[model samples]
Target: MAQFPPVPDTLNYIFCNTPADFHNAVWVLRHHPYLILDCEGHDLGRAGGCVTLVCVGTPLAEHIFLFDVISPHLSRYDIDALLNLFNDRNILKVVWDGRMDYLELWSTYGVSLENVLDLQVAEVVSRGVVRGEGEIQRMKRLQQSYISTQVSDRLGARLDGLHAVIGLQRCWKECGFPAGNGKDPAVVKMHKSIGSRMWVERPLTEQLLQYAAKDILLIGILYAQFSKQGWIPRLPSDYYYLLGQCQRYVSAHREQGKSAAVDAFKPCQIMPLDVLDHPVGPKYRCNACHRYLSLATYETVQGVAPRQASTSEVPRITTLRRPRCRLCQILALRAGFRMDQTYLVT
Candidate 1:
C-alpha cells in the first residue's frame, strides 16, 4: 500500500480541540497579517451541514492551526475571537471559491467574513478578459477568450482546466513543490470517498487530518507565489458588491421557499411570454413549424433557468418558462429540426 508523505518537520501542525488550545491558536493567528482559510464539512454543498473543521495557515510561519468546530472544544469566547480575526480588515483572509464557505459560516455561526481575498476571483482577474463587446457577450464567452490568450505552450497551456483543490495542487507543483510523491493515490481516493463524511467521523484519523492541513497550507504557498508574480490585483468595489448580492440571495433562499425566493429576486433579462400572455390563450408560435398552436399542441420542455434551492419543503419544481415551443421541442427530439435555423417568436 502506498503511504502518504509525511509533513515536513519545518512546518507546524497544531490541532486545537480544547478551550485553552483554541485560545492559544487564536493568539498565534492574531499576529499574522494574512492567513489562508478553508473549512471542511459534511454535505458542504447542502445548506444544512455545519462546518466541522476550520484550518488557518500562514506561509511565513509555515504553521497550520486546525480548529475542531464539531467537538465541544471551543467556547463561545473562542468562536467570537475567531470571528473577530476574520472580520478584521487589516488581516486579510485568503480563500478559494469562497461562496460555499461564506454561506456555511453565516449559517453556522452568523459570522460574516470581511477583508476576504478570494483566490478564485483573483485568478480570473489575473488572466484578464476582453470587455466592451456588448450585452450579447456572456461572462462565459469572455472567460473562454481569456483562457485562449493564456495558452502559450503545451505544458502550462490550459489554466482554465484547473479548478478548486486540483488547481491549487497544480500551482504548488509549478512553484517547485514535490509533485506526485508527496500525496498517495490510494489515500487521495480514500479522502474523496470519505471527505463529505468528515464531520460525522467521531475521531478523525491522522491521514484525514494531514489531508485537511495540506489544503490551507497549499493556499498560503500559492498566494505567496501569486503575490510575488504581481498577478494579484486590487479588486474593484463592484466585485465585492456582487459577492454580497450572491450571499444575500443564498441566505434568502434558505429562509423563504425556492418559488417565493425566485419571485422576490427576478432576474434581469428578456422575460419569456407565458401561455396566458399569448393573444390566444394557451397558444404559442412554434419557431420550427412557424405556426401558432394551442398549448396542447406543444410539449413543455426544460429550458435554461435559474438554479432552484435545495430544500425538503420545496417540491424541487423548475420554472415552466421555455424558449422554444412544444412542436419545435418535439421536432428537435426527432432529429428533424435544426436549432441553428430556428428563430424565437419574439
Candidate 2:
C-alpha cells in the first residue's frame, strides 16, 4: 500500500523580521482593494502592541511588502517616517481576531488599527461558532490523515472545502477549495477562503508574507461568493451603515470617558461578539428603554436602542421630558424611555 504523509493540526508560518522584507510588502499593498491582515504582540497588558510588518496585496499579485520595525542601527525617526507614509487613504481593511490588537496598538504607538472588516465575525455568523483550529476545514484535513491510517477501513474517505491543503503556493494560483460541509459536505469549487473573509495586518517574515499575502488575496475572491459577478460582490447598504454605526458606538464610548473611544476605529473594536469581555459592556444603556445592554451586543448594532415588539408594528420611539428633548420625551414615553435612557446629547 502506498503511504501518504500526516496532516498538520498545528502549523504556524513564521515571519521574516528584516527591514528589507518589510519594504517589499509595502510596495505590493499599493495595489488591490480587499486584503487580509493580522498582528502579533508581546501581550504586555494594556500595551506592547507594536506592529512588526504590515502586509498588503490581493490574490495573484506578487511582490508582497513587509514594513518592519526600524533596525537598531537606524535613527529613531526612521520608523516614524515610514508610519507617516500610510496615514489616511481610501483603502478597505480586514482583520481576524482583532480585539487584542485594539488595546495593544494604543499602548504601544498612539496609532490604532482602524477601518477594519471583521472576518472572524463573518465566519461565526456564517459557519457557526468555531474555536482554535476546530473548523470543518480542520476536520477535513483530519479526514486525509484518517484515511492514511485506515486505508483498509472502508477507504475512510476524504472531505475538503472552505479551507484548502497547500504546501507553498500563492492564493491566486493554487488549486481552490470546494463548497459546503456536513451531510451536505459536497464539493463547491472555490477561489479563496471557504466562507470568503478578508485580512489586514503586518507580516512577520519574507516567507510568512507569502502565506499572509495569499490568505488576503483568497479572501478578496471568496467575498464574492454572495455576488452575481465574481469581480463585483454584492454588498448591502447596511454594510457601510454598520460601519457608521460602529463609528457612533465608539464615539459614544469615548464620550463615556473610556480612553479607547478615539481608538474605536481600530480593527478589534469594530464588532461586539469579538469583544469577549468588553470593559464598556457594563455601561451599555438603551436610549428608548432604560434597560442595560452588554457592550458586546450593543456594538454589533446601530440606530436608537433596539426595540422588541411582540406585535407586528414597531412601537414608535418616545422622548423624555423635564428638559428632555421632544425626540426623547415623546419618543421615550411611547417607546418607554427611562432615566437610564436619558443622557447629554451633544
Best model per lDDT? 1
lDDT of 2 by residue, 1-346 (tens): 1121222222233233455444444445545664445443233122212444444444322333334453344343544443433333365555444444444344445554455554443433332222245555444543452222232132222121222222212212221343211011111121123321122133233334444444444444434431222122135664654344333322232212213212322222113221222235244344432323443233121234335666566644432222332212322332333423433311
Where does the lowest 10-residue lDDT sum fall in candidate 2? Answer: 180-189
Cα-based lDDT at residue 224, candidate 1? 65
Q: What total of clashing residue pairs does each candidate reach?
A: 1, 36
**Candidate 1 per-residue C-alpha lDDT over 46-165 given as tens digits, one digit per residue, 9 for 90 to 100:** 534567888888754377888887677667887777777876767877876564566677667777766777665454334433223332233344234322323222213112222112
- Candidate 1 achieves a global lDDT of 0.54
Considering only N, C-alpha and C atoms within 3 Å, which residue pairs clash in candidate 1?
299-326
Evaluated against the true structure, the overall lDDT of model 2 is: 0.35
